[model samples]
Target chain A: MSGIRVENLVKVWGAFRALDDVSFETGDSEFVALLGPSGCGKSTTLRLIAGLEFATSGRISIAGRDVTGLASSKRNLSMVFQSYALFPHMTVAGNIVFGLSVRGVSKAEQRERLARVVDLLGLSQLLDRRPSELSGGQQQRVALGRALIAETPVCLLDEPLSNLDAQLRSEMRNEIRSLQQRLGIAMVFVTHDQTEAMSMADRIILMRAGKVEQSGLPHEFYERPATTFAARFIGTPPMNVLDLAPGADGLVIEGGAGPAVLPAGSIPLQLGLRPEQVTFASAGQPAVVETTEYFGADTITACRIGRQRLMVRAPGRPGLKAGDAVHLAWETSVQHFFHKESGLRCEIDPAAPAKKTRVAETTPQ
Target chain B: MKASRNALYGGLLLLPAAVLLWTFTYQPIVTTFIDSLYSTPRGRRPAAFIGFDQYETMFADPVFWKAMLNNFIYAFATIPLSMAMALAMALLVNSKLRGQAAVRMAYFTPTILPMVAVANIWLFFYAPDYGLVDRVLQLFGLGGQNFLGQPDTALAALIVITIWKEAGFFMIFYLAALQQISPTLMEAASLEGASFWQTLRRVTIPLLMPTTLFISVNAVIGAFRLVDHIVVMTKGAPDNATTLLLFYIYQVGFGYWDTGYAAALTMVLLVILAVIALVQFGYVDKRIHYR
Candidate 1:
């Protein structure tokens, strides 16, 4: 197995910078996900690593050798594309054996690997069927099988599960992660979906606007996002931010609302709260429910308070109506603070214990 | 209610076009079929109908059989070779290389030139002493053979020119098909350690089969219908090597002033073309695996 190292990689297409001095590394056998929104350089970074796109500057090393200018075929890596890209005329067995044949593996070894892949992917019955004759999920398995049969040291997946439906996406995501673990190959996955990265990656590199927002373990990023974009981008119902000015006690929540205290001498303050972090209570700033969505296990309530609207993800059976009024509260430990201008997180306060605070998680409809 | 009325009005607007098609297109085909059985002259009305006489006479004509054989050879020679050249050209133009626009324009320029103009240019190029072919052959100390003047080489020369003329046109279809293939597929193939030829054979060619079938069908039909170049360059050759079915029909119709026999030959050409089209569809239909 081989690890990959990308150092200050830059890619420029005329005046536009698709990737700007992006740098990161993946340990051997680690599953790292490059997670970001559209136009965020996540895919560009994957291409650079795969040698599909040439970086204008900097070096990329695989297994301690610089492969920056090598062709993708010489990179000792395998990739699965989002389109599945199964050969339309080739049978499932043919597709699986293609990579091995290209590498000049003997027929016996090719058959052995092919049999293993077919058995692992449950593709034995469909080996004779062409790509068009198979279902979308079945074709996806064939694409995966083709990549896996090569047994390359590094695997790159560019949104492999994006084309699959919701249920299949989750199923395939688990299957892919398990396969990577079992094989002990370093894998780099690129996706716009944060949930996929969070659930599957050993390390997640959150990127935005051709730059790295933050890079760390999933739990660490969830608890302490180094930047505002990371906190907002990594979570569903994203982090609710409220700008505040330095006040005498701590920091002002709104203009005249209670002081949501920060550590003393904290500069450029902004408050961050997740939707689930905020609790609805009776005695607080009243918010009228704008909408309520029932999701069987849990109900999400969208409510408006004063001039702000926010989504609240709470426990089972939210007994709230569209016109009902409620209050919002949160634990102090759950709140995140950041610098207003730079969007970087405020200094950590190790001495402060977990404390409760009252804030309205609502926005005007 | 208003939407339903608008839909009805939209369909009613096409009725005129439908009626025009029925009168102009459908009427001619049916009238031609009826006229193929009779010995009608140009100025005659209510001519005497001689059932199957013209057809029997057409079947026995040596010229008609020769034209039929020539047409088959012309189609068989042109379709596969031109399609292969077209596929190669499409692949070259599809690459991310410098000056791609200039290269594509140069390759596609032949397709846009009129057939008559191309034939005129090739005529001088095939001229005995001062022609491009002779000049090049003389440079290599080789004997300059008369290309368009000999019965043995006339059809082959035409076949070569026909391939040259039609390859670029078929390339347009292959280029479109190549563009439709996702770039991600090639990247995936490369990352799987596939060499250039392996990727082309395994990934690109299989996906391009549908476009190949469609282009071949059109190329075969083009080979049959287009004898304009032969008329300009060889005019049925040093003896009769370049006399295609359509050209033979022109000879019988205009040269000998035999419209009855020409109509019978026309029916034969139509039947042959129809069979070729049906065979193409049958072959393609069995193998088309669209994904």
Candidate 2:
């Protein structure tokens, strides 16, 4: 009630629903990231909260006040656009003070806010320069300055750092995080980059196809994903999903050489293993290394098991080469199982152990 | 030798254009300047050199001063009015409204129609009593007045027609510019708590400054160059009230057959256009951001 709350928000464009009954709430001073790929309704959710777009049927309130039917200007929120959207004709100071000036704030008050924001953003030397004259990083800072100077209850950012280069993006990400903390304002950051979300947001709302797949802390998303979609989306290398079918002995790896078993009543389970959970053991399911990518500290090796591919992350290169024979092994504790049809994560009983049958000796064809 | 050959090839490629430019454009401009220094020849008599004589006569002619004054007023009034109307029309059509294509085509119809034809259509509208305008005024129990008959109203009526003919053409350019602006900017402005007028004043208008400057230059040139409506509608009637510089030049050169005096008047028109171009490009252009 003290921060931003959106309930049952729906945005329909003709027949396609951009957002479907989306509900979320942010605490005061909470930084929430609407994380999703393109067309996942992340930006649309931000826009609806900013009041730039109307919800088909829902309620949006900020600071205990209902603003579902309010115009964007009256909503009393600020937004930083991906394009930085600084007025091309206005100087850095002009862009930052534009909102105050237009709201008919007293001249003395405008100058006071302007000086505070300029100093906060370190924009003293660049105040007189127009947007065109400023560099990309400077423009991004000015965009931040514009939003921060308003000192509104909530601030919405639509992929604000997406236009910057990698170095500047990380730098601004930290700046924005610290600024949000210093001001203790509720902020909703929308981004497709998991790293940006994980590094910046206190809460991550993972959306897929206009619906929330999962919403929790960043580590909660990585450790205990609610769904298979969440598991694959939250990690960098992504979780590997291998299909399994019932066999005479146990649940056999569908396209690979392995004799594995699922719990009773498991409906054609798919085994989910993260790359770091996989290792090159002395004996396990047989796979042939197909490719190896080195990234200074660690190496990710792509191994072919019959027709299915599995990625194994090994620290310090592991001296692996393509065409080498390897056996993949992972602890049952780290393994995640999901029903192949519904794609929902299946709960495995802690007392039961994953049964492994005969190790089939199959050579790469 | 290779460089020389390349230079020769470039010159050869430019030869036809240079020849045509000299033959048609440069030659006429130089000839006009030379001819302006002399008095036109009479029947069975040779022309005589009278340096500045045509200029002296032009300065003394009250009709010439009237034409100059009328041209300035026409430019000053029509340029800003048409541009503002164009921006409004562009904004209206740019939005996703019903029948938007039809509305855009309707606004642009006057630009494609010949000026003579448009003037003829306006002629009926301004025709003293039974005209469309008078009929509309009659609805208010007001009698129809001669719109194009009196000297005061004639120029004003012509000015209105020019604005109608020109605003739509300028709208096309403004529409193109307005479409190029990212829609996210509007969303960002609204989220920043900017009102509609404030966004237009701060974001839309400043971004459109380059386009406005481009349209203004064209409007200035067209102001001095266009006189087809004057020739068709008033023909400088009601005591030369609506006679523009170009129309007076046509009268002096073709009707009175005073080529020397007409050339002098043409030089004045050319100088005015040149000054406008210089002022726009040298001064105003620096303030406009290309993007």
Candidate 3:
């Protein structure tokens, strides 16, 4: 029954603002991943929510009770650090029971809770071992076990999987998601990796600088990016952004080997096409293949049109050479439009006039 | 051949230091052992070997035994108190308080002051009649007790001054240990629903163990070697209340002109210090497993 609400949260470090008047709400048992690049206030927001850090100016409420001035212990929230800061002196069982021991639970109850968490995390044999004896993945599980034994309403994880190897990260990511669902706890996870956010989060809050760019279902962010920064950040090989100038006929991309007339329904400003969306066509902008990366299932061809480089992900393997010429275009529905100066998306509504002002920004532009 | 040449160069560079150590360090210890077994006087003939009689006589002397017992009490008393005070001071200095640097400087000031200078200053403070301590006690209606003059309180008074003078030195080690702890653990503990005291006891204190053991061993050795303050201030007076082992050795060899008994006492002091060193190293070795 623990829902979290942040109202007008602001974090200012002397002159730099890390979280600038950000506000959001998480329903009961919701798993929200605060996703952004470095310095985007995602980690800071999680820390503030966990009471590891205090907001400069904001109101925080948990389960409808205001917890703005409460300390971490009083707030009854658990956090797993990125470094897996397990108590080095304590064994796994001892680490798991630390919170219960501090709360003055009976020895029997502490043992019961310890057994439950240890069994859940598969730490039976490792109970007698100290944190240093465990591998990185095992240490992470122990850290999560310590937090879980507390049975707090809300759990905050700050890049818990970032320290693991790639295969272990993916495995542990699924494990953590399943664990959170089983426990039915509201969780705020922070990560810079978009793949992690997309795979695990019920809702993803994408941020930039010190503000929320957009937060919604992962598919919504990718298919309809609201800002140019979000558009460039969300994908691998990323979205291709090319300059467009309004011509007498239609919107023609300015710099390519040969000019390209944008497909109908495309806005007359800057345009973006995801690498997967763009395809080599017989009749489109002329491009010289600069490099080709073979990734088994798909081949990403890096094409240079004058000064502009467009990445195209072909369906199958590509045998294109560095000096080969190719034509590139995308379907009208898949292209994104943004204002040239401000980088705000240009809405393509047929009901409105040819060009409109006063636009709003969304994430994944 | 290159390795041998490098070794030769290294050995050549170390020759002067090796010669100095042999002359200054080994020579004195060997000479002391030899001299302790002989009989000689200022205006007498050359020394003659007079084996275990000196050691036996010194054992029978009650004054020497009382001094040895007093030294043990002094060492145990001052070491624990000094180590505790050092730990407390380290915690205070490690905290995020305003004027922390100034507080650190103040705590460390006593360590830099020479022991003789400190004794001179404290002797005035514990003076029976016109001392600052008596004057302050009198303001609260608790005056007229001779601190250094009375046998009951003289050793206790000496212990207090020793702890006050030396706790800051041990605090530097504890402070280094405290600073080495990753602040992330403390933050993680907080998020795990641990109170400040719980974090201190569970996280900080356990991590400070190696430093504590190191400081404790050194404090015990310091208790034995640094009996000069008692020598300067009390002089083993008021029925030998504050008489320590090293002071007893000094009184026997220099003041009483009894070198054999002094050497026997010096041997006892050596054994005690050796015990402290062994325990320190053993505990540190065990601590490395956790570290």
In model 1, pairs of residues that clash are A308-A362, A308-A363, A308-A364, A309-A362, A309-A363, A309-A364
Candidate 1 versus truth, CA RMSD in Å, comes to 4.6
Per-model chain A TM:
0.91, 0.93, 0.91
The candidate that wins on DockQ is 3
**Residue B285 local lDDT, model 3:** 53
User: What does candidate 3's lDDT look like per residue over B59-177, in tens digits?
Assistant: 89888788888888888899988988998999999999999999999999999999999999999998866899999999999988789989899999999999998899999999999
The interface RMSD value for candidate 2 stands at 1.7
Top candidate on TM-score is 2
- Measured by TM-score, how close is model 1 to the native structure? 0.87
Per model, how much of the real contact set is kept?
0.83, 0.67, 0.80
Instruction: Show pairs that collide, candidate 2.
Output: none
lDDT of 2 by residue, A1-365 (tens): 35788899999999999999999888887999999999999999998988878999999989889999998888888889888888777888888988888888899998999899888889999988988888999998999999999998788898988889999888999999999999888889999999899899999999998998888898888888888888888776888888877755567667766645454454778878899988887777778999999998999999987788888888887888999998877676677778888899888742365443323222121
TM-scores, each model vs. reference: 0.87, 0.94, 0.92
Off by over 4 Å in 2: A247-249, A259-266, A353-365, B1-20, B136-144
Residue ranges of candidate 1 with Cα displaced over 4 Å: A263-266, A280-331, A350-365, B1-56, B141-145
Could you give the interface RMSD of each candidate, to one decimal?
1.7, 1.7, 1.3
lDDT (CA) per prediction? 0.83, 0.87, 0.83
Per-residue lDDT over B1-291 for candidate 2, one digit per residue giving the tens place of the 0 to 100 score: 999999999999999999999999889989999999989988987778999999999999999999999999999999999999999999999998999999999999999999999999999999877999888888898857788889989999998999999999999999999998989788777776778898898889989999999999999999998989999999999899999999999999999999999999999998889899999999999988734
Error of 2 at B184 (Å): 1.9
lDDT of 3 at A305: 70
RMSD to true structure for each model, in Å? 4.6, 3.0, 4.4
